[model samples]
Structure formats: structure tokens, C-alpha cells
Target: MTGMFPATSMPDRDWWEALWPDPSGLLLSLGVEPSMTALDLCCGDGYFTAPLAKIVSGRVYALDLDPEMIVAAKAEVKHLGVSVLKWIVADAGDVAELIPEKIDFALIANTFHGVPDQPALVKAVARTLKPRGLFALVNWHQLPREHTTVLGQPRGPRAEMRMSPEAVAAVVEAAGFRLLRVVDLPPYHYGAVFEHKG
Candidate 1:
């Protein structure tokens, strides 16, 4: 079964912007290069997908389980006048079969901790990546939910559901990926970049 991550539903756009501030810069910091064939896995509302498309000149594939989210993402990218190479509405667990070509980078943000079969998901991602391909995860810091706030209110997944960088590395590395580095995204998030060892 496809497991929905806790708090996977996006916050209001205002709060999301307030938290991320600059989605494009965040992607760049995660080692997304212009020439890379990228996938925005679980691309809720295309907040990062549009910017990623702009960065890579529309050579990006975006997928989310929610068709409504995909529609919103299509509209978001349309509003921005940039295009994604493909928009897929399917479970994230089926990504290897969904994407048509090997990807240089894949990003799943704010949802990794809730995946029911993270190792399986990582292995599926490993199958879709090119050798030495990058997989980036953006997750909430493993802090008490009450301690991490946006707009003066607690936000993100429950405290017990959060995963530390080391924990993430252990799971991902076991599935044929090497942890590259952990980037502090500040105010309650961190970005972990991994390289697929094919």
C-alpha cells in the first residue's frame, strides 16, 4: 500500500513561502544543476517544481499521488510560464516505473519521515537514477513539534515521526546510496543529499 506521509498536505501558500522563502535557492543548495534530468517527487502544488523547471529549462518530471495536487502544480508552472517535461499522478512508491528515463537528480521534500517503507522507496529510487545520481531529501529537523513553529504555531510532522540525518543515511545507504552531505535549512529543516551507487 502507498503510505502517505504525515503532514503531507501542504500548508497555505503564504506560510509555505514564509518557511521556504526561496525555493529555487533551496534547490541549488541541494546540488541541482542546470543540465541534470530532475524529478520532483511528490511535488505538492509545484512550489519547487516550477523553479526546478526554470533552472533546468523544462527538463524536469514532476509526480504526486494527488491528481488535485498535480493540477495545482500544472497551474502553478503555467502561471510561472515554465513547463515541466512531464506531470505524473501516481504513488511515489511506483516512481521507477513511472519515470521514462534515468534521472540525474530526484528530490522528495518534507515527506520522507512518514514513508512506511523507506528502504523500499530508496531502492526504487536507486533503480531510476543514473550512476552517481543524486537523491535529495528535505526533512523537518528532529525537534519537538512544539519547538518548531511557523507563524507562531507548531508545524510539521509529529516529534516522534521525525528522523535525524544519521538515521536517514543509514536507511538510504543500505539501499545502494552514499550520503553526500547534510545541509542545515534552518528554522526547522535540513537537506540531505545522497549519491546513488550503481
Candidate 2:
């Protein structure tokens, strides 16, 4: 993931959770079902992965490119003492190889802008998902200059690197996904939900 924000940029686990309060609520708003099998692509620090494990009846595959991030995520979820999660240290684009089972949902949050090959990544997600499976993406919205230049911004990619919702939808559609809906995630982000055409 060249030209991407490094894992070091991520805050401590608690701090990160505080920043994105109520991840479960957000997932539910995005149509994440409790019994669905999910793949948390680039699941850094288990911010979403841990909660996903709690909700999903099947399994949650938490995969990341950074080994340290995976280690931290595993530790973060260990308190729950649940075996619903399979933590894998791998690129987000290798979902087909890394996850053998057909996924009911795939969540890519906050890291889509940093992905080196957007089309390839989407294709991989499509390949791993079951027919009509959902792919939810939460990404930083590319706003105008005035909105993005806040001093001492705690997080988010560079302004130029951020992808607009339209841009994201094009990539998703090119990979054989049907764009379903777009929702405002509030506080500087938006979510796009798509379904694998199969």
C-alpha cells in the first residue's frame, strides 16, 4: 500500500474507539446483520473487528497488511474471549486466497483511499463474497479546500488522496458490484453500500 498512511499514524486502541464512538450502531445503520459472515479488510487495531465479532454469528476475518496491527487487534479482542474472529496478516487485495469461505459482508473502513490498486481490491472482495453479498465502504469524504484544512487534524489522509463518493462508486461498479446506496457517516466520512452482482 504505497502512498498510504502508515499503521503508525493510528492512535492507541482506546483512543481510536473513543474517536469513532458506537461502531456497532454505525454498522447496523449500514445494514450489517448480526448473523452475517464478515471480512474486515485492513482491520487495524480491531476498532471495528472486535465489535463485528460480537455481532456476527458465523465468523469475522480481520485482515491487515501490518503484522503489528494484527497483533494489537488480537490482543484487543482477547478480552471478549470469543473465537469468532480469525486474524490474518495479509494485504486487503488477497481476500480470495486468505479467506476460503464465502463472505456475507465485507467492510472496508477508512483505508480505501490508501489502497494501491482499488479495482483489484474490489475484485478480490467480490470474488470472496457470496452472490448478492454486501460490501460496505466507509471513507474520508473529499471536501473542498476550506473544509479539509483544519489545523492539527487528528486523522485522515491527505486532501488529494481522499476519494469522492462518485469516484468510489465507479470503481465498485467496474468490479461487478451494483451500487446500492450512499449514506452520510457524519464527522468527515461517508459510506457506500454495494452488492456483488455475481
Candidate 3:
């Protein structure tokens, strides 16, 4: 584990929603299917977790390093009256050991850039997923932070930390995954989907 992902990678909820008004729709566009078990890796406050649980018939595992974040995520899921398969508070690298079963899909949104050893984290995710499972990373396009504002405030990680789709694909592919496709997320982000080569 490269420790917790940098906090700057996460933004306030208001701007987060402003940037992604339809999280569930976004997830679907990223190829999340209702029948596949999913994992919300580095799940911040569960903004997407609640909707993810809704999509996968509550067969979603939400994990974050911060306990407070888990509490908030639990509240969010409760507010929606949906349940997650498990709400785990642990480092992202510990995902394989923490989840009871291999997942069919995994998502790490907005937090991939800050990972100190990106390839290591990608390998960890690969280990947690079932063979041929999909892993999707939603990352800020390599644009200046000031230009990617939301709710009238510049959001997301620093400009230098932002990654282009090709850069992300390189790292993930090196970790025993095949690049599937990159989906344009508009405005300031993109989703890169990879299939585990296991």
C-alpha cells in the first residue's frame, strides 16, 4: 500500500455533484453492469457508492482508508435505503485481503493520480478481481487545474498530478491488464476501462 491517496484528489460534495450530476448514469457509461459484483475502491464519502449499490443489487463493496469517510458513506447509503455488500475501512492496497469474494468490476474515481506507486496499486486491484474482470479509473484529464473548475471553484488534484488517458492505460496495462477503451467524461475527465489479463 502506498498509504492513503492524497486528500487533494477529493473535492467537496457540492462541486463533485456539480461536475457529475448523474453518477449512476456515469457508472453505466463506464460499463458497469447490474449483474456484476462491484467494488468502489477508495470510495470517498459514498456519493457514488450509494448509487453503485443501487445498480448492482446491493452487491457492492465500498472501501476507503478513512473511517470518517466510511461513516459518511454509510449515512449516504442509509439515506438512499440501499445496502452495500460490505463497508470496509482500509487501505486501497488491502482490497484483495479485505473483500470476501472476487469482484467482477472495480472503480477508482478521482483518486488514482495521487497514488505514489501507481503500478503497485493497479496490481493490487487486479488481484482482487475475478479473471477477466473489468477495472475502470475515472481521472482528471491532463488539463490545468484552474481550467477544470466546478461550482465556480477550481477542483481536483494538482495540474501536474492529472493524467491523460494514454498515461493511465500504460500503467494499468503493465499491471497485467489489457486496455479496453477510454470513454470521454467531458469537461475535465475521462474513464479508462481495462480488462484483467489473468
lDDT tens readout by residue for model 3, 1-198: 545666434557888778889999999988899999999999989989999999998999999988889999999999999999888988888788898888999999988888877888899899988999999999888888799888788777888888888889889999899988899887788999999989
Clashing pairs in 3: none
Q: Which of the two candidates, 1 or 2, achieves a greater TM-score against the reference? A: 1
Candidate 2's C-alpha runs over 4 A off are: 1-9, 144-154
Model 2: how far is 173 from its true place, Å? 0.6
Report each candidate's C-alpha RMSD, comma-separated, in the order given.
Answer: 1.0, 2.7, 1.3
lDDT by residue (tens digit), candidate 1, 104-138: 99999988887888988899899989999999999
What is the C-alpha lDDT profile of model 2 across 1-198, one tens digit per residue?
532344225555554555468888888877789879998888887778877888885388888878888887787677666554577877677779988789899998888886767899999999999999999999878874356433344456767888888999999999999989998876678899999999
Q: What is the lDDT of candidate 2?
A: 0.79
Ranking by lDDT: 1, 3, 2
Backbone clash count for every predicted candidate, in the order shown: 0, 0, 0
TM-score of each candidate structure, all chains considered together: 0.97, 0.88, 0.96
Candidates ranked by TM-score, best first?
1, 3, 2
Query: lDDT of all the models against the reference?
Result: 0.91, 0.79, 0.88
